[model samples]
Target: MIGNYLEFNVFFDIIGTIAFAISGAILGCKKKMDILGVIVLGLVTALGGGFVRDLVLGINPPNMFQNSTNAIISTVFSVLVFMFFYFRKNFTSRQVLIFMNEFMILSDTIGLASFTITGMTTALSLGLDKKFLLIFVGSITGVGGGMIRDVLAGTIPFIFKEQIYAGACILGSIVFLLTRNFLGDQVSMIICFFTVLIFRLLAVKKNWNLPRISD
Candidate 1:
């Protein structure tokens, strides 16, 4: 039952949201933005995707507004991340910077994977069993927040750069829908999450990218 997976769903969403929120905060810091600007970017990166997803689905009053838990999670993590980066200059060394970069990548991958599965399953519940819509929504939900953050930060979104990030989402979504009927929703979601996560990690390691046209 959906209720049985409630904790499971919330746990992943929280982890994903926190991850993305920190990514946004880190970007904001890099952009030399103030604390408030970092907070805004972080929250936007955390919830923008779900807002767009719910809005497109015509679900009035998106869950981001209705659910205070995600908002609190986003705000708390965003602020904490910003503060950590802001204060680490004097005491922290080069290793800390390397760790921060690695942590950001790790969290971003988790966010991408978790959101892809969450969005796909949510669409399925709404009776959108179509292949294209499920994949579209799933991919959008995974990357939408990051897109918003990047645009607001005056940079190109990651997906626009020919990275394999969204591609991983699309593939995972398709796999999730295909397996859901036979494997059950929870099982499908778990598989889909790992699919995207592993795929992106592999792509990053291999330096994979879409073929870019001229210079």
Candidate 2:
């Protein structure tokens, strides 16, 4: 059903899953998790967002679990990422840590963008009409997995910790809704996906952040 309209979306889904899986594997390694634990984190990070969204929407069984494609994809990527990190064995080096951290951030950002668009498209297809629900669903699909991954990894969630994480997702979701009337569905999704991606990248590069109260 979803595959029909999501001609190119499935591809983004695979890429996003791989990206998030790698990020999860990196975090799991940082937390000193074993291979099994790392794999669990990767799977959760890849699918947790959709799981939450489905539960909220009463989509029993969830889409990822219904078919084995995404699960298999995530698992393979997780194992490959874990092996790469294991073989490297240089986490202590400052340069190595910096490079790995940057890479993780980049992967996370890509996943966030891909998932945001996917979520909005899915919600629209589901006949969900409210703007808030669309944004909320999109945001959840974008960051829900990362939230679970961070919690399991014993660190602050990126959506909460990063400068403009969920904000970027929200903005992208809004863009999708706004452009729906004026643009084709495919074009709208692409615009929204890039909106989140480019926005997050710019925010990170420029150190843009929401204001925090005095400490």
Candidate 3:
């Protein structure tokens, strides 16, 4: 059971890393950043949340430094995105921008769901049984990287003002906590991931946003 859980956790972590890297790379390309900037943005978006989570949990060195696979994966993907954009004949075409925007949303949603699972699972594996802490860590791991990416890209983080982003992660964490014991870790993770993914997609489609003071 422990081995299975570790496998699942690592699987989801890699998926999240790839998705976030692509999203960050897209943002970098759109921002007209060079290859180095794109790589930096991609790596940050792919690993920043995990790094922060480890710091919060007092895990020195963090997993990224301990294992370089994720960094290499993110860097390779970022370079691919840069090359694709750089070599495109119509890099600024409206249709291409639209497609990239759509792809970004898909990647971001997948990353959000995948990382939420990884965060909660990591917390549980460490023998931390506090529900609130699990949820908090999960939410941070799900959204922290994207938040940093947006700030670096000079835009307000989507979680703060756009469609239900962090809210979806928080809710997903809740779902995992509620179902993990009864349904087991794997099943609970599946439910939690889909919960965030569907909720985020629906929010995007419906233009859902929290009530603002002025709005």
Candidate 4:
């Protein structure tokens, strides 16, 4: 059961990585960044979460270096996506926005859920006891890539201002922690993913936001 759960998690991680890489490439293209910049954004978005996770875990130099497959996959996928957009530069803003809205929603949801679960799993393996630490790690893993991507692209990080962005990650981590023992690990993961995704989409549809205080 554990082995199957691990395998599924790894598969979701790869898919999430590719999706985020595509998102980064799309954003780079929108900003009229050079090809090198586009590739950089893609690489950062794809690997940034895992890189941070490894660093926090003290896995010196990181698994991104140890695992050549991940690096190659991220690079190849990014380049292909950039090329696709590069050839379609004539697309209107409305068309672009439509595409971006759909793409970002899908990619961000997957990335958020996968990273949250992975972060929680890592924290548990590392013997972290605090529930809040699970939430923090999960939120960081989910948003770290977009933070890096936005910084590199000279834009505000979406999660800091966007509607209920990191909320999904927080919810996902909570679900994972709460249900890990009651359900099988794989079942728990699936439930967490769907819970986060559904909540995120609903938040968007409803334009949900936390209360703000005026300074």
Candidate 5:
């Protein structure tokens, strides 16, 4: 069903990988991890979601291991992030912290949006037809990496505490599934991507949050 949208899938996959890698690298910097740690964190955050998704779908070895392109991309970007901070020696530690916080949010939001669509496309391409399963897989693909990154970084997963994270992905998946037939795959994918992106950004901007028990 999604065969004709292969180009869109690949495009979003790359975008998502790069964005997630950058976000992970930034988090590493915030944690004061070494360069190697930064790269490892970035790789995990960029690929962890797909790793889980493929494993659940029974794809042995997973795409992250099957191909080296995304891995290489993640590594290069992680190193670049490290170097970027390294060379900005004039910036105070507080300044760096502030900048990283803002930039990480932007990259993570983009990654969340892009990967949500890619996850749905992957399920659709593999002939999965159930709506709930598609949304579930897509949300996993969108947020799983960040969850792993946070855990490895010794922080609570933001999706559980921060503004609408996986919820944005679920909504985007629903939008894509709803619009795909009428708008066509490419258009629907674009719409879905932006839907998640905008929703996430707005959540951050407005400090939106689901109800939780008062501490």
Candidate 6:
């Protein structure tokens, strides 16, 4: 039972990484970055969460570097996305922008959920027993990729904005931690992913924001 759950988690992690890499590549293309720059952005975004997770877990070298398959997959996915966008660049800039925006939102949501769960799992393995730390690690994993992508692309990180981005990750981590014993691993993971994704979508749709004080 435990083996199956672990396999499922790894599967989802790989999918999420690839999705984020594609998203990064697409965004780079939209921003008119060169091919090398696009690939660099994609690689960083795909691996950033895992890198952070490993660092926090005290895993030397990080799984992203140790696991050759993950790196190869990320690179190939990024290249494919870059080529597709390059070929389609003749389309109107407005149309391309719209398409990229839609893709970014969907991909980012999936990546956020996957990385959040993975981060919580890493924290658990690292002997982090506190719920607060789990939530913090999950939020970091969820937003780390976007932060790296934004820095590479020379834009402000999205999580620093007024959006409910990290909030969704925190909610998901809380759900996972609260229900893991009751729901078991697989169901708990699914619940967490769906909770984050749905909340993120609703937040975006409703323009949800954290309260801020004006100077």
Cα lDDT computed for each candidate against the true fold: 0.84, 0.85, 0.92, 0.79, 0.93, 0.84
Tens digit per residue, CA lDDT, model 2, 1-215: 45544776777788788888888988887777899998999899999888888887888889987988888888888888778778886766788788778988999999999988777767767888788988999999999999999998888887766779999999999998898778867778788889999999999999888887767
Q: Where does candidate 4 stray beyond 4 Å?
A: 1-4, 126-130, 213-215
lDDT of 6 at 94: 83
List clashing residue pairs in candidate 5: none
TM-score, prediction 1? 0.92
Using TM-score as the measure, what is the rank order of every candidate, best first?
A: 3, 5, 2, 6, 1, 4
Tens digits of per-residue lDDT for model 1, 1-215:
56645666777788889988888887777777889999999899889888888887777889898888887888898889888878876524677767766777778888999888778667766767778888998999999999999999999988988458899999999888788788887888889999999999898888899988877
Residue-level error in angstroms, candidate 4, position 211? 2.7
Q: Candidate 2 at residue 169, lDDT?
A: 95
Which candidate, 2 or 4, has the higher lDDT? 2
For residues 1-215, what per-residue lDDT tens digits would candidate 3 score against the true structure?
56657888988999999999999999999999999999999999999899989988888889999999999999999999999999999999999999889999999999999999998888878888799999999999999999999999998988898899999999999999898889988889999999999999999999999988893
Itemize residue pairs with steric clashes in candidate 1: none
Total clashing pairs for each candidate? 0, 0, 0, 0, 0, 0
**What is the RMSD, in Å, between candidate 5 and the native fold over all Cα?**
1.1
Candidate 6 lDDT over 32-111, as tens digits, reads 88888888888888889888877877889888778888778878988998888778846457877788888888888888
Model 6 stretches with alpha carbons more than 4 Å out: 1-4, 126-128, 213-215
Let me know the TM-score candidate 6 reaches against the reference structure: 0.93
lDDT of 1 at 143: 94
Could you report the Cα RMSD, in angstroms, for every candidate shown? Answer: 1.9, 1.8, 1.1, 2.1, 1.1, 1.8
Q: What lDDT score goes with residue 27 in model 6?
A: 80
Instruction: Choose 1 or 2, whichever is better by lDDT.
Output: 2
Q: In candidate 3, what residue range of length 10 has the lowest lDDT sum?
A: 1-10
